[model samples]
Target: MTDILDAAVERAGLPVHWSWRIEVRPRRRTLGLDVLPDGSIVIAVPRQTTPEDVTGVLRERRLWLAKAVRRREALAAEHPAKELVNGEGFTYLGRHYRLLLVDEQTAPVRLRGGWLRLRGDAGAADIVDWYRVRGRHWLIEKVRSWAGRVGVEPPEVLVRDLSTRWGLRTKDRSLAFHWASMQLSPDLLDLVVVHELIHLLVPRHDDEFRQRLLVALPEAVVLESKLHDEGRRVWMGAVRAAL
Candidate 1:
């Protein structure tokens, strides 16, 4: 039987108090609510489970489920839609950059006078590519500056778009920064930098590695939370506009 059918039988018109979206897949398993990495809540039930059973479980875990959903909704609200246009501003490395439209340039994006000027013929793709290049240069500079203070220099830095991750570091001391990360706040971007640089010294995220990261960035946890809440929407919007 379908999970919905079962839930209906068990619930039998249970009073509506807590509400949640339920999903039943044809998996050979029982029911569970999974906390997705993107912060969405998923109540996964077997195809045979009825709505009543599902509702019962939901009622049992109402507080847990509600808290998770509320968090996601709040984060979604924080990443409200943005109107990308001339005079609109963005930040980089703790500085503000106003957007300007230019009609003559072949390249789609350029930075000047604390402004990120885009060619009038450009679209989101051009902007993304442009920002990626700029992000690499900016990140590299930041990394070099911070690394010098700690007496550690990475061998190389790579920049590209990556979904589901912000950055990566290899044993060879090469670093990869997500191009999509350009849309993130400077604080989070710097956290990524510190993360990869720390990897050069400690390859694993053990307690010692975490301690080292904290020494470099005391607000890493806060920045990471903000990134988790707003990063995807920011990048997704830009990518969609560019397309």
Candidate 2:
């Protein structure tokens, strides 16, 4: 596999300025390639496909591969630095809250007196850490409220900074949400949280699922559309934060 990758790189004559790696997956039925967030490539091929064939396919897709790799690298470069100091903002329930740095003797983030408060001078990573902790707390409370109203309760709930997708549901009734949803409005955020939790009972998106969701959220379609258009910006902003 290493020899095949080396040969492909040699044949393609790609630039060496950027870092790259390749993974060979024999389970693949055809030549396939994927670009990782760190600008590396993972190439897969069926057991029957020859190295020469893999190289040719990669060569044909070189331009696309290069563009994908560059985009991933660019997003990584845009990730934001964290701080509770002035000029930093936090996204809570789909709204942007400018971090109003205040002089406090504690080292914790709080939403007090109608402001998202981070009570220490911390870097971007710290701010994210605060969110990972406090954010889940907020999410759990909100999800419980919505679940009660919807008459559905997931067996478990999880929250994290997911790189893709708003939320997911597991077969065992575990519901997960992308922490970035905090950037959205409370109503929209609740809608998403409830939607994922309901999937614990109804695992697939079918008519019954839509019906239940509508009963749970009368404005589900409207909010879903808004998410499709504007909600993507939140993820994009998070990617830019990588810079």
Candidate 3:
């Protein structure tokens, strides 16, 4: 199957700048193309899909696939990593706070005197936990406010590592946010909050959804662009041994 798809993509004459793979999804009814966060392409198709069909679909979506891959590549290049050391900077709600290693602390991490205080023994995981705890509390209130503006009840909000996504509205009608998003500015954070809240009303990103989102966030276009640019700089748990 892999050889056949590779040959098909070659015959399709698509640009070779991006990496791609084929996935046979047993339950998938139609061909789907996805550009992963790291700029890899995934071509998902039903089990019996032929190389010819895959080639045709790829050709039809060639322009879109190129654009998506370029965007992912740009983001991958801009993504930032962190070092777990004193004087290292961490962002919370768009504010940069220097990490201060302390000999003793009540918790593994805490914000005190405008510094992100970390216990000398704590590792990167502890810092992530700190963000989760802080983000959950902040998002709960944020979700409530956005929900009210969208004329819907606030759903249960959770904060954790959401991988490539910044936010998700689950089937249970609850909202889950990536803890890294706590690094976003308050305005960008509000955009994310209101985006999920609006999803509670509109399930898909269609025209109606865009109209409603614009009503809720007048500066959605500008803020979304900024979010994409700034979000790449947020620390996503990568840490160096020392700087």
Would you list the C-alpha lDDT of every candidate in the order shown?
0.69, 0.70, 0.89
- Which pairs of residues clash in candidate 3, taking residues 3 or more apart in a chain or in different chains? none
TM-score per candidate, chains pooled: 0.57, 0.61, 0.70
Per-prediction backbone clash count: 16, 19, 0
For model 1, what is the alpha-carbon lDDT of residue 129? 78
Better of 1 and 2 by TM-score: 2
After best superposition, candidate 3 residue 108: deviation in angstroms?
0.5
- Candidate 1 per-residue lDDT, tens place, 108-183, comes to 7888877788887776677667767888888888778778654586458788876567899765668888776777
RMSD of each: 7.2, 7.6, 8.7
lDDT for residue 78 in candidate 3, whole number 0-100: 69
* Residue 114 lDDT in candidate 1: 77
Global lDDT for candidate 3? 0.89
Query: By the TM-score metric, which is better: model 1 or model 3?
Result: 3
Q: CA shift at 240, candidate 1, in angstroms? A: 5.6
Worst 10 residues of 3 by lDDT: 74-83
The true-structure Cα RMSD of candidate 1 reads: 7.2
lDDT by residue (43-146, candidate 3, tens digit) is 89888888999889988999998899999887666665578888999999999999999999889999999999999899889999999998899999988878
Candidate 3's TM-score reads 0.70
Candidate 2: tens digits of C-alpha lDDT, residues 5-34 = 678667876677755565667777777788
